[model samples]
Target: MTSQRAVERGASVLIDAGSLTRCRHRLYLDTAYSALLRQEPENPGVRQRREAARAQREDIRSRLSETLDGWTEIEAPDARTASELTMAACRRRVPWIWNAVLPIERTTGRRGRSEILMLDPVDGGYIPIIVVNHKVTDPGRGARTSRLTEWAPAVDETRKVRSQLRDQLRLAHLYRMLDFEGIASPNAHGGAIGYRAECILVHDLTTVFDEYDARFLDRLSVARGESFTVPSQVSECRSCPWWTDCRPQLVANRDVSLVASGMRADALREQGVSTIDELADFSGPEPDNWPFGSFTDAVAAATAWRAGVPLLRRTDEVTVHRADVEVDVDMESYQEHGAYMWGTLLTEKGGPPAQYRGFVTWDPLPTVDEGRSFAEFWAWLMGKRADAAARGKTFAAYCYSRAAEDKWLLDSARRFGDISGVPTEAEIREFIDSEQWVDIYQAVSDQFICPNGKGLKKIAPVAGFEWRDAEAGGEASMGWYREAVGYDAEPDTTQRERLLVYNEDDVRATKVLREWMSDRAEIEIPTLESLRSAV
Candidate 1:
């Protein structure tokens, strides 16, 4: 529900409580465009994607209704508001109260409030007003708690206490009477109970309410065009409609933000260093308040961006253990069906080039069967390790990150393996704890700072490796999986082949990164401990 205070205080467009709780600039721009132009200022593709997402949300809501029964739905007084709020309530499985203007008098001349209050029934006719929001994926525990703290006060103030008790009712007291709940899908597991629910009570609700009040006032002015600027976040900008218009200017001027990310760019700009050229050529003593803790580190990053090469900041931090027999591993999984393929590229000490292998599930299966497929992959990996041992060569399985690959290995073993299986918990843990399972991404990040990005797709190209499929990406591969597995239609053999090629490239990229780092021994920087001591 939107804050009634926000509406009456002259907000041009009402933002949902969930969205307003994060990224004020995004809300301001969206609101300003909608208010001034009467439509969203988005490109066709963005608009189409938004529409598709909305449809998916609606589908989830419909499915939720089928699962959750016997909940009464309350509609708004106005037809349009009622329709929207009703759908929202149905999806959230809470009773929605619309046209529920705050008791406070209108202060900023706006006539109507579009906020909807939801009520959750308790035993013996007790109903606590709840603020509900839905997310397609896990918003994380910290974020959910922050959202509850932000929304509680507004909900508390909307409470209708008796006239006699009104004098004793403070915002804090009201906040305690209300509740907040978020429904979120933790993973891409497409099932009825895949969505998890989290509820929280705000202890510092009054303080947060005051802060939110002031922040909303400032945002309202921006929404009305007092001031506006495009967000400098590169990730956000890439998907933004104005990116094409803004990118050329940023490039031509060598915007510092291109080299430095997050608040560091702003910090640099504040110091009158606003371009990569200026930063690279900077000769003055270190600024008194360097954002990166040390001037040399900042300069190293700038130099790397300017020269278009990875900057190894600390030689000793580069702890990637090279092996005579290395296996670069990458996995492709449809979250809906669990992990289905484990691809590996094997390289020997004097081998010609990396040899590719894939362990794939060729048929749709139950969760148990999926686990069995993973077990097979594990057996193959162990066989490779055994062959390397027989040849008297050290073997290591290298992956970009340990989080996913490691988790899958352990989880699959727990789900499918016998106590003595190749990927038993004990075996996987020993492998990971030893030098046998190398996380190249962690090693790269610990040693070098790549201004372009740290992603395999970004790093591999600079190391002279390229994917054959230009459209190969994590999301694109997921789409390819759907097509290949015939999730919605007949299986496409071409798509399956493309998926394998994509997987192969991913594993090969890790091998390429490993070799590239190994060859740069001469360029290694000081050890991290020494660098810290010097700083």
Candidate 2:
């Protein structure tokens, strides 16, 4: 059900709700391809999202069953046949309904299923509630909320709202379907249960539906072959099945999105810089506030990409943050459950030779054991730092990107601070703010323009670094994590070893990439000074 494509047109009255919130090209391709080719199976990313949503919904239903009564769950022969069962459950005046499918709207032809349908006693109708895999609320106030088992009319000032665009639009899609059938609550509101499962996030859909209607119509037009759309690089492309169909086309046209994306790519196209060659051959003064790096850097990125260069220097001099002792760290996690491992490669400048250590827990995540593993890792890391400090050596820990490491560090402290050896949240903040931590990705981004992207996998090969495994990526590792921890079956020691090896390579890649940037980058990569005359 997390599929962006509407598979088996017989099961859908129109495009899926996701089309209103995702890339238009994905919707167009999904609609056009159903008739021309069989739909590709959902990728691991989509599968994980779907599974997480399912698990959350089931947990919500289980809690609701325990706390409330008069709940009916829709069960039918198939998805296409579930509409009647859902409608029957609704007519019974149940306070809660699970897995309810609303019939297609006659006017807009939208069909949807809700994880939960909450009855409004005043109107004798139901409000749609969706279950999602991420956090729905933040720590603050002024967000209207409801208890898990009941919806109150007044705002719950104790809770705050975090707006998730896709989840909101999905609620709008279901509400519209119910409203068209005259089964929607007069309240004109819906709710969602997020990963935290703490409370129902109430959304006033009056404004949201306005946006959804326009978006849904645009997607519907694409579906009915009334509009044209083209594929572009987007956040969703990393997991999109249609990338196979879109990538070749982009390559053939030398699309600008290959090097720049989002508003940058759109703005470039508007400026008549649609192709890589046009961007590379640009001869004018640079635009104000060019993203990531300078305008010359973007041109260099385009030129290098077009000419098949891996890395191009954007500055005459290059230096990566290094110290007398360094440790490269990488984290591996599964679908927001928890960070299961922290892999580290310790390289002492003159002391003992480099060593790799992994602090890992095979226990399936969302477990307290996670806290123990995290505390252990933190203790070991601090011990190494202290050892360096005692020896009067400047210490630094590196990661390709600080975002993931920062998130887990803060989260580990926040979630497990009470556990022995775990630091306080303030300590994590102190370390993150200090010069003792470095992001090699930032150093590379500051000094170079990588047309292919600055991902560790993309840049490591240029530094002559290679991973032993053929399938080495975050997505692939998520699959390995499932098998390694026995989330659905018996644990595989082989997969666990594979994960350790992959994690080790990731940290080692950062070590090598940093060294290459310090020692050889300026000499080997095309310099900005050289590309200046050419552009």
Highest TM-score, which number?
A: 2
lDDT of each prediction vs. the true structure? 0.57, 0.83
The TM-score, computed over Cα atoms with residue i paired to residue i, of candidate 2 is 0.92
Which regions in candidate 1 have their CA more than 4 angstroms from the true location?
1-11, 17-69, 73-218, 270-272, 281-296, 307-320, 335-337, 351-353, 362-368, 414-422, 520-535
lDDT of 2 by residue, 327-434 (tens): 999998887788999999999877787899999999999888888989888888889899989989989999888998898899888888778888999989999899
Off by over 4 Å in 2: 1-13, 35-41, 122-124, 153-160, 283-297
Give the deviation of candidate 2 from the true structure as CA RMSD.
4.1
Please give the lDDT score at residue 218 for candidate 2: 86
lDDT for residue 87 in candidate 2, whole number 0-100:
84
401-497, model 1: which lDDT tens digit per residue?
7788876777677667753343668988887888788898888777766667778887777668999998888756766776787765899889989
lDDT of 1 at 9: 37
Instruction: Count clashing residue pairs per candidate.
Output: 0, 0
Alpha carbon deviation, residue 532, candidate 1 (Å) = 21
